[model samples]
Target: MTNNMKHIQFNNVSYEQWKEEAIKALKGKPFETLFTPTTDGITLEPLYTQQTVIEKLGDQLEKQISTIRSLKATKDFSSAQQIFGETAEQFFKNIEDSLERGNQILTIDSRVLFDWDETNISRLASILENNPFKLVLQDKNDVILTVFEQIEPSSRKQVSGYILSKEPIKIDNYPNVRTISANTLPYHYEGANVVQELALSLALAAKFANNENNFAEFVNKFYVNFAVDTQFFSEIAKLRAFKILWKAFTKAYNAESNIAVPIVAETSLRSFSKLDEYVNLLRAGNEALSALIGGADVFTVHPHDVLVKPTDKSIRIARNVILVLKEESHAASVLDPSGGSYFIECLTAEYVEKAWSLFLEIEDAGGIDAYEESGKLQRILEEVTTARLKSIEARKHSLIGTNIYANPEDDFNVETNPLFVDVKRLSTPFEELRLLYKNLQPKISILTYGKLKNFKPRADFVSGYFATAGIVANQSGEIDSIADLLNWINKTDSQYIVFVATDEDTKTILPSILENKRKELIIDVAGRFKEEEKEWVEKGLNGFVFAGQNLVEKLNAIAERLKGEQQ
Candidate 1:
């Protein structure tokens, strides 16, 4: 083989050319509608070019690119999976098993410390002496921190790990352990957008640093944790932006700007649902990849059933997601995989700029602590949470097995952790609705009229819509006349009946069926009849089910009606 490469020449298309083609493909839909606005107040364009990147970064484009590219010294990340067990022995066994299967860090939850005996503490100390660990402390109580005291000073010196806690911890001999954590997971769980998360995390770090007399020591022992969601490129950009923001933040304090801040990223549970739990696996995979490409120092994958009791299989699968990405895909072999892409670079820049501004705002408000104390943070979180829940309720945002495309037959009998009761998850409303319908066991029927072609689509829509709430609607055989519809409705025990047919057929037959049908049956129509809505209501139509309507609201009304009938 010669020391040469084959090259193929192709026509270089301008951004305008691409835009023109995209416009043509849009087929008269307003091209501006392609612009998507994120909750972070950033508008996402459909396409990004080198010119766009240049415009965003201005004179600092090359510097920004270089900074991001150099942010990670290595792409390798430790798999820091939490070991869950009800008892100390089981927890140790799980830790051993997880380590053997490629879990690099011994992740311990503080709650598990309550079950530890002297022997278990000894065993933990032994493990810590030889391995890296991550301890998640819910508070600064001495009881949980006492676990470190039991370890011999010599052994403790060999221990290397980080603690996830809001307060700073000082272990007598653990020199390699990082104590303070600036975590964005809480805000993320409360529905904070990417910019808010980044800014809040920085504000948290600033608070920690300001409280300490030694800024350098605080910087050395401080690490940040992020709950990576499934927004793929945006999430990758968010992480990258944090590094740039951290550099700027450190420079303001005259600290070393090049110092690397350790990032521990885990897949977010905000989008996880208990209904179609398996879909959570795909979500975790996507988030894990984002964390990998975005240069996290430690990555954790919460098991698909983490909301409930996680089985051994689910935990193993979660661990193997990282293993597969590393060993099979060789993603760890390259640093900054998203470094040069125009879109990612621009996005990273945008995040850095916006997040820095927000961080400054938070700092002016006396940091994260003062902001939280003032209740402003809680109010902001509430607003964002409401907006996000509304999106999920309206079906504007889709959670595969929770809000849209739900499995009506899926059983949700498993007990959930009480700890997650306060977690603001996107799927909670739909899950509650499903559970309500499952308990009610309402008898619903889809009363179809007209030919199969005309009625089947509407019938299917009504059935699927009800199925989302876990109500299986019985579809009646074709009814050609109003008398037949009335006979079926009267004979059946269904408390709710939905009329499904062509608009004209429904208009022709609905009046007669409503006039003759039993008074107790709550009748609704499948399609929207805007002009005739008031007329239909007066004629005894309960409601209408159509695309883009708020499914949660509609289902809640039906559920309320079911409750009223039961009473």
Candidate 2:
């Protein structure tokens, strides 16, 4: 018996009995309704017991938790981040400044920013020696590598690795200098699900492992970087699963089980929004929390406006998010803080099983490179991205300030840098629609009919709906007669008019109101009356604003018509 449960007296309830009680509580709803399926098609149950953990993992669970708990209690994790600068001078300045502001290590993308010649390289080398801070290079070419080779072996020890290079290089196999990385960002940024990310990355690592003559030596220097999203517990489980699976993968090659698999976590840029960019701070904070709780060795919280040139304020907030997680929350002091939860453990097991299956399938299909060359990988990701986009469109997935509770007047005209991935963001369509609407100052009049109980809810819905696109809605008083509604709408300079009434009341007033209404004003109805749509449209209804309809498509059409009218 576990320590916590020892003193507690509990009824001996069978799974069947518990299920019966659950069914009764559901009140005639099917038990299947409680089983939710993830994007990976794994069905998550409403409850989990000790028996939920698989036999293979059962023996190691306590041991692994204990090991991680000890590490968390004893050691302090260092804060690390990429230096954001376009030029060599900016790079050096940013790195120096970052190290001064509590960052222990500075990572550089040599290809993107620091394209240095020998003289500048020597200067950077001098700075490194004097500063005595760790330097990580995302070296794409031989420029950084060649300079490192020139340095004596003792000085060269400070160079962590050329871990971020897309193309694999032939470097001397050293235990200290890691060359292999599970380059997960490409897959992650391009909208691959967590299972896909793990599976494809491990498959690539396995392909590299097979080519190496000394598999153990190659595995030793291997590291991984993950792009964490806002799915709080899922991301936490993802990182933990990576560690567990890495040990299993190494064991297959008859290698040491204790070999370390270093992980660097970065907040995902996929979910970042151009509208109401302040909300990006919340997204970054939540993602950073997931990464830290997941036991990432190094964490980077990208500036909220990373897609554009980040301001000084955004950078400080991003860095401070990590600092707060480490210092104030004391996250680093409790390794695998989510370790013992049944939900997390179950999710971790599911990811591991699904990911391992996918890895094997990739290997069987020749390899990771061969699998990619077939274009099948891209197709799968595209399908998933499409589904996610549709979810956002249907309001199944809510992105506040972008899709749902957006401030239409929010403007950001700053130039954005091109991203490495071609993946589509959920907010792209909504932002485009919003931009179209922004060009026109739209005023909507909600013609409320009948009693307050009959029309108030729909009037409120119309007001919020128009506000999402920055349109001003005038919904003053409830009108019992058609003349009053028409007079009120006509007195104000409203470009559009919407009827908010009960179905019976709508049928009674719409026809009479349409006859007297201004022909130039665009007309729409608030609720979905699919059978009455054709009759209503013939009587001059432009469209219906109903739940479950694609808001992006509807808004875009309206914005285009409004723009045309202005033209």
The 0-to-1 C-alpha lDDT of every candidate, in the order given, reads 0.84, 0.74
Candidate 1 residue-wise lDDT, 1-567, digit = tens: 564445646688998899899899999998898998877788999999888987887788778766766666335788999888877777888989999999998788777534566677677777887889898887787455667877777677778888887688877767788998898888899889998999998898888888899888887788999999988999999988988888888888897557777888889999988888999999999999999888888998999999988889999999999999988777778777888789999999899988899888888898788888999898888888888788788887888877777788887844776556567788888888888888898989888987787788778777778778887789896778877877887799999888888989877888887787788889998888898889879978898988889889989999999899988
Residue-wise lDDT of candidate 2 within 74-154, one digit each (tens)? 155556666677777777777778877877656654555446788768766666544423233445555766655555566
Lowest lDDT 10-residue stretch of candidate 2: 67-76
State in Å the error of residue 404, model 1. Answer: 1.6
Badly placed stretches (over 4 Å) of model 1 are 1-9, 73-75
TM-score result, candidate 1: 0.95
List per-candidate RMSD values in Å: 2.7, 4.3
lDDT of 2: 0.74
TM-score per prediction, in order, is 0.95, 0.87
Which residue pairs clash in candidate 2?
none
